[model samples]
Target: MLDILIKQVKVLDGTGNPGFIADVGVVKGKIQEVGFITRKAKLVIDGNGLCVSPGFIDPHAHDEGCPFFDEAVLNKLSQGVTTDISGNCGQSLAPVSERYWKENQSVHALINPPECMHEFTSFGKFLDAVEKKKIGVNMGFLVGHAALRIAVMGLENREPSLAELEQMKVYLRESLEQGALGLSAGLLYPPGSIAKQDEFVELCKVIKEKNAIFTIHIRDEGDYVIESVKEAIEIAKRSGAFVNISHHKAIGKKNWGKVNTTLKMIEEANQDGLNVGFDQYPYNANCTYLNTILPPSYLVREREQLVMNLRESQFRERVKEDILACREKWDNFVVNVGFAGMLVIKADKTPDAVGKTVSEYANALQKDPFDTALDLLVDNHLDVIAVYFSMSDDDVETVMKNPYGMVGTDGIYMKNKEKTHPRVSASFPRVLGRYVREKKVLQLEEAIRKMTSLPAQRLHLKNKGLIKEDFDADLVVFNANTIMDNADFIVDSYAPNTGIRYVIVAGEVALKDNLYTHAASGQVIRRKEF
Candidate 1:
């Protein structure tokens, strides 16, 4: 007898193949059988003409801290995500350094979550704590370079000393040995920005030696984006590391079609057999901390010191100039897209500012948008979160059409927020409904494959992201005709996807009939060590 059985379902198989009518059986938390199923089960679900595909895997995310919170990834599960790759953008929960531990509260509130950090001194210990949380979806991790820097250098802007370099390599090797899939670098962000090209090449060499992957968020997405891409490609080529470019986009209106050239470069790299590709969100807008709009140097200090730096007249003038430039200079998204393109989505002590742009707020205050943004940063002490309307929908569609491109929410764990980007709750379903069903950009099977096998292969999860026998019984059952993402950008951001009847993570139903069953049965997936 099986643990649970689904009868008369159209199976998509998650291999980019055509669908076939079949029955699936699950037992002992694994997929037991597919095709004709005449066996008995403890629980039976009639698919009612729904499609059953392997669970969707998110290739880029920062939900590593979800385990500490009570909500525990309800937003991701609601979107049919059964697994996600977290510790993205050069941030991880494990391998905490003594300096980072002390400065964590003031320096990085986003990455440090729970009292669990004290119990773990290494990557293995952190994964142990994550397993104890039993989150709603399987999670794979990538050790972050910023975390290592904080542990060793404590936010310094200089290159590591020889000893410091060796220490970071040891940390990376240890984490990879303990099941970290790869190394993630956010060079545009602090701590990681301190690393030079030679530094990155050395770290990539370590990753390559361990038979792991290297994922990077480039130093710039506008203005100097091509130079940034060259830096990343050079690191990969020199070290022979498998590379994944995270959230690949050409920001700014002039840079709208730049992804065309970037994608060509990626293809050329692959043709030369350097193993390079990118993952992207399917939305026209982007989300990040408001402090990013400030000059990178102004953000290097601690919270209060950083605020003081922002208050300096000279720094403020530099910021104004950077935000108004339109050439190959500093990477400023606000200047490139214009202030009208930016809207605040999250901030401190400013609930009314949530849905309005800096320009709108500027007009109301009778100031320029640059001054408006500066005042908000000072008022909120650089804790604001905003959305940037930077990318073109055509570019988003074009990137998705690439055979090497895969889907990722880049969304994190959040619930019951007053205002948020629709991508947080709508990425997977939006792809199915808008891109696949409505626009015919991709076949349903091809879309499912991107969400499944491709990401699994990228992360090297042998037992996940497929519907084959003996695979984990993580699955999604949804109606193709009626399935759609209801979350909107201006309003109703928390609206769940429509036509998803059930979501199974490891043979247990996490979402059934539009409600959580409180059956969180997920595990932390680790890479195979050399």
Candidate 2:
């Protein structure tokens, strides 16, 4: 007897193998049988004309706080993502300290964790709360280096003292003991920006000891991308921890095609006995805080102080000079992509600014584009989301073709938002539709492997990424011929994709006929003993 059964589905078993016709049986939340199943079941699906593969695993996700608002995280589930490796880019919702809450509350808000999370002081407590919410997809998290720094020392721009460093290590070790998958460093953002290489190496030592992974959003993705890649590799070498680069891309026009060099570097490192890999979104553009256009010094300041600095004439001139100079000290988004390339997607105080480029908005206001961007940030409490059209399509394809590469959404979601990166709701299907099916950039099986087994191997989830008997029953069924991503940059960015027919999590049907079943069958995937 089976709890649920599917008959005559074409199975792509997440191993980069050709598809085969088979029947799959599920019982007790695990895959019970495959290949010509003759079983009785409570629920049966005629899987004809559909391909069933292991449910996609999002290797790099930013959904750590999304469950607080929408426990189902329907946007991701709708895309066939059964598991999310969140707490990437050095931001998590837990291990909150009174100092962090008091001084760095705005920074904390960037991850969008609920205010009540501040009351809990440990990563385990936060995970417990999320589990209690009965989320719709399994979630694994990494202890965020920035959160750790803020917890011990609030937004300080210098290296930690030895005692302070040990405290961070203690917090990290405790989090790992309590089920954190690993540690993630957003070196592109502060206090992660302030951290020196030694800080990462020391923290990664803890990660290595715990048999966990280290994921980093490197310091620079523009002019200094090669150096940043080297930096990540060196950290892995020093700490002997597996390092995964988050949302890997080469931004800016002149910096296009740098991924070729970086990918070679990653391969060389791996060949030399260093574990290094990367996750990438399919799009050429990237999204982040609007204030990233300013220098790193301004980013570390409090919201009010940053707004005051922006308002001052002398400070504004100096800031303009720095951005215009295109100094390589940090990633200067404005100089790289230009105001026309930066579009405001979310500006709560200035709704008119949403969906308009900084240049376009500036023209309408008869103001300098830089000033207009500054005003939006100020008007919105320094929390504006913008998408930058910076990468090359060629580079996007090149990275996609890499054998060591995997897929990630790097999707930023806001509750009750009218717009977001299409990757939030369409990454998996877009890969299948545009890249695999339309462009033939990758074979269907290989793309599924990247989304499934490869990331599962990285996260060390032994059971979730394959379709073998006795594995967890997380699967996706879709029509290969009609699968396509409809989400676009200008219109209906949040529209659900087509061709995803059924999504099952832990033997429970969470999505059927492209609609959510509102099932809460997902579990909190903790660190496993290797």
Candidate 3:
């Protein structure tokens, strides 16, 4: 007898194919059968008028520490995401050297608070902790370049010494052996920003040797975006590792349609036999550290020193000058999008600044916008979250239409009443409702394919992307007609999406009737040798 059975559901199958009426049977933790199944089971779901497809796979996620702290991973499970590829954007919580742990604590705090920092000292230990925690969503991770660098070099701006480089390679190889899917670099952030292309090529050699992938949040997303894409392609070509671009976009008004050129470049690279693709969240705005508006020159300093610099009149003017000058040295968010486009979503110390744009907050305080932003950073100990409205609708659609494009939430989780970008909760549903159903930008099957099979295939998760016999029984049952994202920029950022009827992970009903079942059926998806 089957453990669970769904009757008369329209199975989309996760391929770019039209849905068909069928019954699916699940036994143990795998799909037992698909077709006209007359299996008897303990729990049977009448999937009439519901569309069942392979559970969504988030190709780029930042929920590495969610399993340890919140095992349910409600934000992901509620959106029908059964699997998350965490450790994206060069941030993972593991493999910390005891010596550098204190200095690197601030970085890890972005994922987990200080109290939880001692839980994992190595990549293997982190994975083990997640496994023991028994999360509600399957998770795979890429070893972060920043974590590796900090472990060995402690936020040094200079290139690694030969011995230090070897040590990083050792950590990366050990991480792969212990189950990391690949290496991810956030070149836009430091210490990743400090490293050069040569350094990445060397690290990717280790990735290639292990048959793993290399994913990157490139060095720039505005003005220099084309150059950044070229740099990623160069890394892929030189290292022979599969490269996936994280949250690909052309930010700023002037760079609105640059994706046309960048996509063509990626396609040409693929045609030349280089392995490359990109993932994008279905939103125009992006969320990140408020200080990213400042140039990288300002970011390399320690938090206290940075705050000191922000408080200094001379240094503050220089920083503001650099931002307003639109220097090509880094992606200048302030100059590209202007103060009006930078919205403060989270600032614990400056509660009044929350829900206000930098410009608005500055006006209320009767101060300059740059000073208001700098003061917020100083008051908040250099920890603040802001949303930048910087991408074009046409560019977003263009990337989505590409055959190589896949979906990722790039979602940042917030605690208590802290606000986050709506993409964290509304990405997948928004894509289905607004783009696929309402705007007719893509068919349901194609959109589902991008969300499911494409990402799984890219990450080489052989058993999880498709609805086939003997595959992992991770599934989602949703009302296509009623599905829509309710979360928005200002009013509601954490509101759960609508029409996600059921979410099954590892053959267990983790979410039923639009409510999380709190089932801890998820497992760690470690890397397997090709």
Candidate 4:
């Protein structure tokens, strides 16, 4: 007898092979049988004609402690995601001091949910808390280099002292030993961007020794994008560690079509004995806090100096110049200031803001976009912003078709919102529904493989990302023909995916018959410590 059984399902198996009609049985959270299963169970689901595959895995995300801890999880589950790799972009809620939380509230608010646990001192403690809390989805984390730097150097974007470097290495080694998959660096973001190559190399060496991986959000996303990627390659080469280019993209019109050259470089690196891959979102525009796009030097000074500069004439003039360049060269860099500036699909803000554009609010206020952005930044102390732009559909398609690429939403699973990137709610389904079903960019098996087995392999999980006997019963069932992503950029941002009928995490049905049960059965997944 099995704990549960699915009857007459079309199985994709997460291996990119042809699907076959079969019955699957689960026992004690692991797959007991697949193919012809003559078994009895406590629960049996009639899965006739429904597709069963290993649960999807999101490769890059930052939904650590967003508005509510489980706010946006439904969207992900409805799209068949049983696991996700968050704590991305060199950030995480754990291994953080209470003082750091208070001081960095500005950047942390956008992604950190209220239930975020901070009682952990080391990576092991963080994992322990997750297990105790029973977090949603199987969670793997990247030890953020910036977080470590801030823990030691107080957000100073400079090379660490020899003593400070040693302290960071100790923490890095501890995290890897405790189950962190690897280290992630956000080179374009502050603190991380300030780290010199020598400073980063020292940390990467420690990661290599721990038998882990290194992922990076390169230093530049504009004209210097290639050079930035090259820097990441250089790090991997010198460190002798596996590398993943986080959310690989060339933002703005000027950087379009450069992906070909970028892919070439990645292939060259692969030939050079370094395992390299990248993750990408389907849409074109990007989102982050309002402060990220500010002039680099504006953030270099102390916080007191930062506030003073905002009020200074010289700083204002420099800001005006930078705004002009952004508008001229990067006009698509729209402002999503405060709750009212853009739609609030995931936050606990008023419903009116969720789908409205920043331009709409600025027009009502009779102010320039840049001025409006500045005003909001000042009001919120530059806490957060969400921007949208026109990314070439061709570029998105090309990246998805690449053999080395995987999918990510870059958005969180917030439910009570009006305006939001459909990616938050639609990324996975859109891939299966739009790209694979409608556009036929890739085969269904190939797409499923990209979402499941590939990511599992990258993270090096021992029992996850497969649908074989004795493997964890993290599975999804959906109808390929009826699948559709209901979220859109300009409208209906909170709409759910259409075809996912059930999602099983660790043999528990988290989403059943297209509705979420709010089951908090997921555990923190750590790396194997050798």
As for candidate 2, its clashing pairs are none
* TM-score of predicted structure 3: 0.98
**lDDT against the true structure, each candidate:** 0.83, 0.89, 0.89, 0.73
Lowest summed lDDT window (length 10), candidate 4:
328-337
Estimated TM-score for each candidate: 0.96, 0.98, 0.98, 0.90
Which of 1 and 3 is ahead in lDDT? 3
lDDT, residue 51, candidate 2:
94
Q: Tens digit of lDDT per residue, candidate 3, span 1-530? A: 99989999999999998899999999998999998987689999999999999999998888887876688888888899999888888888877888887766687567663355555577898888788886889989888998899999998789999999999999999999899989999987889889999999999999888888899999999999999999999999999999999999999999899999999999999999999999999999998999898888678888788888788999888887878887646678887898899999988999999999999999999999888988999999988989999999998898989999998899987765258898887899999999999988889999999999998888889798999999999999999998999988789888878999899999999998668777889889999888
Worst 10-residue stretch by lDDT in candidate 2?
Answer: 101-110
> Which regions in candidate 3 have their CA more than 4 angstroms from the true location?
113-116
Provide the global lDDT of candidate 4 against the true structure.
0.73
Return whichever of 3 and 4 wins on TM-score.
Answer: 3
Please give, for residues 447-529, the per-residue lDDT of candidate 4 as tens digits: 98888888888878777777899999999989988888887766577677788888899988888867777777676788886
- Candidate 2: regions farther than 4 A off: none
lDDT of 2 at 273: 96
Error in Å for residue 181 of model 2? 0.6
